[model samples]
Target: MTADSILNVRWRKASASDPFDNCVEVARLEDGEVGVRNSRFPSGPALVFTRDEMVAFIDGVKKGEFDGMTV
Candidate 1:
């Protein structure tokens, strides 16, 4: 399905290490892809990734691909 198709989909947060709550939520698409958006910006723009891209991104996270990278 496309992003518009999943526009009304519900999302769940991954997890939170701090009790204060600064985390992101993810929505799993029916087409095997995924959508990620800031938990605070529920209605804002989201990034869509294919299953393989998501997996690779997760792997990169595990390997610190964003190490020292600041937003």
Candidate 2:
């Protein structure tokens, strides 16, 4: 869905996020896909991912595959 379409959905951020809300928020869309957006840009664009794609990304994260990209 487009960013404007999912604006009313409930979004949540990880518990690890700082109090400043500088993090990505995620939500389960009605269509069963996962929606992701930057907490700092709530009205901006969002990315929608299928369940499998989201699972693979989370798995890669757990394996530290994207560690090098972070600070």
Candidate 3:
């Protein structure tokens, strides 16, 4: 969905985010989808994902499946 479509939603970032606000923010869309966008660009585009997709992604994160992605 377009970023403008979800602007009314409450976007939140991780509490552990750096002071520079260089992190992604997430919000729960009205249709049960999850919206992800860059905290540094609140008015930028966003990626929409289904509930199940979010669950899988979060699960993978907890399992360290993306640990190698960082330098």
Candidate 4:
């Protein structure tokens, strides 16, 4: 879904985001899913993920499974 289409939701970014807001934002959707979008493109398309999917992704993140990819 498009980020702008999911009205009335608060999108949050990481606390360590740059001053220019170069980071992704996430919001809890009405249907218990999660919406993720780029902070630089608020009106851009958002990827909707189920709660379980989100949980798995977060778990992987905590485990550093995606580490070193940015480099």
Best by TM-score: 4
Over the stretch 1-71, how does candidate 1's per-residue lDDT look in tens digits? 33344665778775543555466778887777888876655666778889999899899999999887756
Ranking by TM-score: 4, 3, 2, 1
Q: Candidate 1 overall Cα lDDT vs. reference? A: 0.73
TM-scores for all predictions = 0.71, 0.87, 0.91, 0.96
Candidate 1 all-Cα RMSD: 3.4
Listed per candidate, the RMSD to the true structure in angstroms reads 3.4, 1.6, 1.1, 0.7
Point to the candidate with the largest lDDT: 4
Models ranked on lDDT: 4, 3, 2, 1
Kindly list the per-residue Cα lDDT of model 2 for residues 25-57, writing each as its tens digit.
Answer: 999889889999988887788999999999999
How displaced is residue 54 in candidate 1, in Å? 0.5
**What shift in Å separates residue 5 of candidate 3 from its native position after superposition?**
2.5
Residues forming the 10-long window of minimal summed lDDT in candidate 2: 1-10
Q: What's model 3's TM-score?
A: 0.91
Please report the TM-score between candidate 4 and the true structure.
Answer: 0.96
- Backbone clash total, candidate 4: 0
Q: What are the runs in model 1 whose C-alpha is more than 4 Å off? A: 1-8, 17-21
